[model samples]
Target: MSDAIVVIPTYNEIENIEAIIDAVFAQEKAFHVLVVDDNSPDGTHQKVIELQEKYPERLFLEVREAKTGLGTAYIHGFRWVLARDYEYIFEMDADFSHNPEDLVRLLAACQEDGFDVAIGSRYVKGVNVVNWPMNRVLMSYFASKYVRFITGIPIHDTTAGFICYRRKVLETIGLETIRFVGYAFQIELKFKAWKLGFKIKEVSVIFTDRTKGKSKMDSSIFSEAVFGIIKMKIRSMFTKTKPHA
Candidate 1:
């Protein structure tokens, strides 16, 4: 098994699952994948199973009965990876928005460079997103700024789903206490890591909107992130912060 495992959360992502898995495996670096499928009726899980036959050791799957929140899926994957011997655990999307090629750079940021968490950031290099409306681009950009102002975390892309974390960092953070399941969940995890004195590095990447699959973004997820940041910030005041691992 590889030292790294990439966890991808999927819903109705049948159109993108196969290609994404292939793209990840095609990378020069050795990285295993775990697909946390929420019982996609579109047969997303079956596609993963088929791929697993070819990459028996590199590819794995976890199917759930019903659709749960994205945060829970990742939390489950994190716990599973921790139980094993993976040195680096990643969070990625089943949709092809996040570039698979950038996984190398993310890994380098931690393995070669000295960073505890590496974020595949879209905004660190001046809005590296394509095929998105101006409104959405602004919302996402400003959202990160808002999160930064509220939490005092110096991350550029606060809601970036593509991230690589060293095993020790995840083990240090109390994963069970993670609350929000929407986009805010991303921010919360990063905030807790930063609060605990983990060094986070942002690797510039281009985020292209997925062409084949439907988007999961909605007003509710945005609202959760907007309000959740305040709660997360306030809670951090009372709670004792964990030091760097």
Candidate 2:
């Protein structure tokens, strides 16, 4: 078995599911993939089942009963991987927004460079997003900036979903307590990791908007992120703990 596993959370991603799976498996590093698919009406989980025959032990699937928030889906995947022997656990998109080739770079940050968490950052070097309208881009770019300003987390891409976490980081962070389910979920994880003194590294990457399938971003997700940061910061102050790493 490979030491690394990429956990891809999916919902109604039939258009991109098969191709994304192939791109990830084609990588130079042997990375196992566990797809945590919320029961999609589009038969996305069925496609994964078919591909499983071809990939055998490398590709795995867990179908939840209904579509829930992205954070919970990832939490489920994290628990599943933690139960096994994998050392490197990743969070990636079913869409091509997150480059499959960059998986090697993220793995290097944790495995070779000894960082606890590696984020595939869009704003580290500059805003490296493609195919998105100017307004949406600004909202995302500024959102990260706002998060950095408020949370005192030095990360440039605090909301980036493309990430690699060394297994112990997750084990230490107390996954059961993770709040926010939308974009804020991304911010909350990074904040907690930083507060716990985990070393996080951002690997610059180009984030391309998906060509297929509908985008999941809505006003509620954005609003949650905007308001959630303050609440998170307030909550962190009262709680003090020793670093597990």
Candidate 3:
């Protein structure tokens, strides 16, 4: 079996699933993919099943019952990957916003550069996002700034969904304790890893707005993140973090 796996959580992503799988497989390095689908009525799981026949060994699919939050989908995927022996694990979006080609760079950051977490950062190289509204651009940019000021992680894109993690980092972190299920989940994971003294490095990458399907962003997700960080920081203060080996 391959030592690296990319876990992409999906919900009604038919327009992009097949293409995303192909893009990842087209990479120079051999990496496996696991699509954790949350019961996409648009036959997304059926598409994955079809691909599995072609790339039987490299592709996988897990179909869930209902629409759960993004964080829960990833947490479920994390547990599935952890049960196996993958050394390098990744979190990517089904939408082409995150370039599949850059997965190699993320892997290198951890496999060669000694970083435990490698983020596919949009702001690491001065706001490299494309085709987003000016208002959204400002909100996302300032959101990272607010997160940095509050959490003090030194990361340029704190809510970035595209990331790669060494297996050991997940093993050290108590996965069951992860709380927030929105974008805040991203911050919580990074913050917990940082608080435990893990090395996280941001790899510069371009984030394009998805050209197909609808975006899942909503006001509630933004609100949860705005308030959740404070709770997470407070919990960290009261809780004793385990030492990294």
Candidate 4:
């Protein structure tokens, strides 16, 4: 069995689910994919079930009863995968926004190098984003900057969903205590890892806007990320967070 598992959360992603699964399998490096589907009404889970017949060992699925937050889906994936012996765990989007090709680069950062966490960063190298409007681009780029100033995390893209975490990093950060089920959820995980003194490396990756499906980004999600960081920082002061070994 492969040591790496990429946890992809899905909700009405039928347009891209089958293609993304095939793309991930096409990667040179072996990576097992776990689709945490939120019972996509568009039959996303059915597509995964059909493909499982072909790649049963490499592709797995966990269908949730309702649409929860992205953070909760990943937490479920972490617990499910951790029960096994996988060393590397990944979080990626079902949309084509996050390229499957970059999976190799992300895995390399933690597998070949000594970094505990690897991020597929867009702002790390002059905002490497494609097909996004200037305003949306600015909002995302500056959001990372704002998160850095507020949380003191050194990484450029704190809200990047395409990420790789060594088993030790996930094992260090308590998945149950993770707050903010929206965009802020991404920031919360990174902040906890930083506070624990884990090594984080950002590898440059181009984020393309998904053309096939609707975007999940909403104003409330952005607001949650902006305000949630402040509360997280305040809580960290009074709380005793555990560090990785």
2 against 4, candidate with superior TM-score: 2
lDDT of 1 by residue, 1-245 (tens): 79999999999999999999999999999899999999999999999999899998899899988877999999988988899999989999988899999999999999999899999999999999999999999999999999999989999999999999999988888798899987789999999999999999999999999899899899999999999899989999999875974
**What digit string (tens of lDDT, one per residue) describes model 3 on residues 1-245?**
89899999999999999999999999998999999999999999999999999898899888889887999999989999998899999999999999999999999999999999999999999999999999999988998898888877799999999999999889888899999988889989998888888999999999999999989999888898888888887788899987697
> Which stretches of model 3 miss by more than 4 angstroms?
none
- Where is the poorest 10-residue window by lDDT in model 3? 228-237
On residues 148-211, what C-alpha lDDT tens digit does candidate 4 reach at each position? 9987889999989999999988887878889888878899998999999999999999999999
Q: Using Cα atoms with residue i matched to residue i, what is each candidate's TM-score against the true structure?
A: 0.98, 0.99, 0.98, 0.98
Greater-lDDT candidate between 2 and 4: 2
Q: What is the lDDT of residue 200 in candidate 2?
A: 95
Q: Report, for every candidate in turn, its global Cα lDDT versus the true structure.
A: 0.93, 0.95, 0.93, 0.92
What is the TM-score of candidate 1? 0.98
**In each prediction, how many residue pairs overlap at the backbone (N, C-alpha, C within less than 3 A)?**
0, 0, 0, 0
Evaluate model 1: give its lDDT. 0.93
* Cα TM-score of candidate 4: 0.98
> What value of lDDT does candidate 3 attain over all alpha carbons?
0.93
User: In model 3, how large is the Cα lDDT of residue 13?
Assistant: 96
The numbered model that scores best in lDDT is: 2
